[model samples]
Target chain A: MALAEPPLGRTTAPTRPAPQKVWVERIPPIWWVLGLFLLTLPAYANDFILFQVFGWTFILGMIALSLMFLAGYGGMVSLIQMSVAAMAGYMVAIFGTSGIAAISMDLPWWLYIPIAILIAAIFGTIVGALAVRTEGIYTIMITLAIAAAFFYFTRQNYTIFNGYTGFNLVVPPQLFGIDWRQPVPFYYLTLGWAAISYGVVIYVSRAPFGLALQGIRDNPRRMAALGFNVTAHRVAAYTFASVIAALAGILLVWQNAQIAPGTAGIPAVIDILVIAVIGGIGRPIGPFVGALIYVLLRTFSPDVLLTFGLSGERFKLLIGLGFLALVFFSPDGVLGLWDRWRARQARRGDPLTGEKGE
Target chain B: MKAFVTRHPTWSLIIGFVVAVLLWLIFAPWTEGMEDVLGRKRVFLNAIFGGVTLGALYFLVASGFTLIFGLMRNVNLAHGSLYLLGGYIGFEVSERTGSWLLAFPVVFVVVALLGLVLQNQVFRRMEGEELRQTMVTIGLSVVLADIMLWIWGGQSYTIFAPDWLSGPMTLPIVSGYRSSGEAVMLKYPAVRMAILFAAIVVGVAMWLILNRSRLGMLIRAGVDDREMLAASGVRIQYVFLAVFGFGAGLAGMAGIVGGTFQSLSPGEDTRFLLASLVVVIVGGMGSIPGAAIGALVIGLAEQLGLVYAPTYSVVFTFLIMAAVLAFRPQGLLGRA
Candidate 1:
């Protein structure tokens, strides 16, 4: 059951060339307006909205971006990506100069952050090593088992993870004496990290490893026949994705000023998957778009519904309906539809006029 | 039977059984000088019984999961949601009609019909698109869980059983001797025994249905090769529908049984979903006997770990799963 390749000798330039570059050049006008709006709104928005909702959304978007790299590019769908981040978050809290035992032991941020990322990366490697042998749903289940096991261990092991209450880790020291927790400071910090992560993801997506991974995604057998060590590449992809998630995890702990099992457990893990899918899979900007939608729904839907006398819990129902609708209508996600529309318009244009007009 | 026994050597079987028993003995809490402690031995035995009952419930749900995956090659991630929805439906029906028996079958039928409709409408439309189907099912699961939360509050609810089944039975086993020179006593719950019976019946029925019936033959053929079976003039869609409904109905039945064993909460959907996924992976997807073995391993590991290493019980299962996958990904009794 391999799919047949499209026949060669099809017209390559007539319907495609100009608009492909045009769409690439034409940045959506809405983004500029939206950016300006966001730049101005922080001054007027409440501290809670700016710090908690926006900050957490950015952090979550960062984590979802890591999963997107694997699932969208490598065809490796995993459920334990959140667990890797959670592990990093927990390590930060455990090793940081906070929690119950912190009076006896403390580590500087420089030393602690690297150690946490290393620990999370090693954990991800081990999981990937075990999971790479399976295909499709088996891979998903194995990751889920790993995640569930971690959740249970963290929930019950109080001496180590501080038990169910979790650890109240100290926030990162403000740069140049700026109060990071202040709404504007935190939002900017989150946005800066998000931008860096997004840029790295885009760069990686176009790199040789990304192309090879996409090759494996399209046809693993062919890639293997072409001398690519498929398993090794998969493990490498997972490790890189894990590092990305770990960065987000560190940021998450910093934003919340704490790390709990609940942050990385099944519900939160599944929510990340929801966010990725809602935004669009395999697209560079999907995670950011999805995060915006999710954060807005999570933040405002409760108050919006409460005004109509409905309970806040009904917000989940709305979110659930929205998710279903998105999946039904746009399986490739919003970005996919946008790309398709541009392609359609390019196919409809007069190809000969392009060079003549130029 | 004699020929079969002779051809299949019993050495591996005997060794496996002995090892399992030794592991149980080593991990059993009652052996840790706990007989003298008041109610410690009782609690230990109760936990074992609880574990076994829970294993049966897992088998019930995973049986359906494996069957669906085997027949259609679609991993119904929403199976847990269907189970949760079934529990809520059963809860509502039982509350309205004041009859638990009516609620049981009614919930099963409703969920079965729901599965049929979903298969026809959503899954069928996305046939051959495995990833899309998976995502859509996940979306549906989230929607169902949210809707269920809206209808039934997130607080846990207990399913009431009759007085006869609810009470405990005193089984006078040599539950070990106390340091104070008294015989330890253990009272197992009657509900657990009832669950054991249900497991046995379901297991046997599953065997007979898959091996002895015409419909079972068609299902087996479908799993082996759907296109060939269709080429043979059999309508594969009807078989897929039947298998899908049967699988979902099994999940509903499990919900009814599990609701009595554990508190049914909105969160249990995700917990059970994860558990089902683990079972399928460890047992090898689509194998009934494999599901049974996987459930037993997970259930026993969890129970024993809770007794000896409570802090690491959850991690223990994952470690076992990892080891199993590393060494024997096909799982016990599963085809490679």
Candidate 2:
């Protein structure tokens, strides 16, 4: 836990032996139990606890999960994931009437859903096209710039994006006569989608394409020599990740009934990065866990800080400190810490992270 | 002139001609209020003054950024936070000592020490690991930003220039149909002029150090081939440390220069960082001359853009960057 002492970068890479067995990866029984427990939480918890706390965490987690999918498996960092999400949210608001009549065309809700997701996917692909050619720092800078561009565009373009005020009062449409925004219904809707997306990410990482991506991440030139199309794979990864983020964006709009410029702002984008990173980038579950912690800190930090006679803005200070600590101590993330704890318990002296020791 | 133009038309003449025409096209229309000659002249002069001063400040930040990044291949995203720290410290120091000049060295020394700790602790540990370096530095910046917010409050602050530089001064150059004997000199803020002068000094000093000195050769060599440079027995780590400190020091210097004129806010750190990125992207990273050109272009575009389209001033820089990236990804001066 004393990551400060370890003088990081002691090694070049976090190597672990790839898990070879297939049968061991079956949907674990604990997942079913955890899923069931999560499903039932809405029944016991009140509206605020169910919707605001859990619902917000799950929605934000979905965005972070999309990031994790790219960063963990595809070996790309797309800061535009949140932008894609916000785009979907904005699309829904524009196509359907929620608020900002100046921009809203007031089309049917169903028509906009696919269009939003498709646009986001296309946008993601375009961003990836611009980004994938550059390695490392260039890739990060380009994506960040694109995200910033989107934020500025949305904030300044009044006719379409409604400027900084953005669109408000966006509620989920009724289907089958059940109000989707209702606490239990909303929670179930979010949970069901989150699970499917999580499953997709897990499945893809084990898929041949995902393996190819990982190979490219390790050495794109070698992968290219081996006949893999590195750019295409990277672009495909962005497209897929964007679709996931877009869906979460739709859900995000419904949860807040509002979508604003701040939703796609750099700080918000960076927050998603922090969540994905703090949760653990190595596995699928890390984002949700990270999101849960982030939500708790954000929701409760006001009361927590008030006791210490500190302003709520200082909550950001705590979050920043927590992020720095997490990065230094467990670069792999909270899930990485969990794995290390598990490895310690097993007493096998196994390497705690991805790459197996030589 | 003809021989020079014929010899290097593509590299020198065409680019220069294009830039000149573009500037004329953008600024020519501002003379619409020529009927009020004084007003038109003042506006034109202010735009030029503002653009150059902003560019100079940007150069200070980007020069440091390009140096650290080029030499070590490390991206210290917290460079902006270092700038903010310097400004805030400068703000504090200037307030305490009642002498604004004292803030410069105090900030330089403090930020350099902080940079030393950061390099040894964070950057050193993550050599060659760009992703980890980015994440750690980002995290460090976030922490630093939040801490500053806590100590200085969340609102924006504008540091006043010391009395000498606070007021506007009349320039020798005049505009419109000024009478030969009249004091029709263009009035400009002394602070901005000082900053422009400082930026030029830093720029010239950096050029001399990089192009003329043995250490400059080593640093350039390090940027070109770190392994080869180190294999030749130079302590590359020391070079990285020194450059990192110098870069941080430059950020601090910009913070002081900028804080005195432009407003300093909590969010300024990210804005400055992004501006530097655009600078580096336009100017080839690791090339000092490249950064200067990039900053001037971006700064002028930002000011002109503000005049033409107030809401989209920032977007103009990104457009420039996007255009550059599309045509020349290595940057205008960056070696392919």
Highest DockQ against the true fold, candidate: 1
| TM-score, one value per model | 0.88, 0.90
Which candidate wins on TM-score? 2
Among all windows of ten consecutive residues in candidate 2 chain B, which has the lowest summed lDDT?
B26-35
Minimum summed lDDT over a 10-residue window in model 2 chain A is located at: A349-358
The TM-scores, chain A only, for the candidates as listed are 0.85, 0.88
Stretches off by above 4 angstroms in model 1 are A1-49, A99-104, A307-309, A343-358, B1-44, B96-98, B170-172, B177-186
Q: Write the per-residue lDDT of candidate 1 for residues B147-202, one digit (tens) a residue.
A: 88777877988777667788887666545667897975666778878888888799
lDDT of 1 at B119: 88
Query: Candidate 2, residues B1-336: lDDT per residue as tens digits?
Result: 577578777877678888797566334443445536424655556676788889999999999999998888877789889999999999999888988888899999999989988998888887877888899988888889888987888788778887878788877665444446443667788888988999999999999999899989889899889999999999988888888889998899799888988878888898888888889988987889999999999998888777767788767877898888888888988888
Q: Each candidate's root-mean-square deviation in Å?
A: 4.8, 7.0
| Per-prediction fnat | 0.81, 0.53
Per-residue accuracy of model 2 over A295-337 as CA lDDT, tens digit each: 9999999899999987776888788889988888888999889
C-alpha positional error of residue A111 in candidate 2 after TM-score superposition, expressed in Å: 0.8
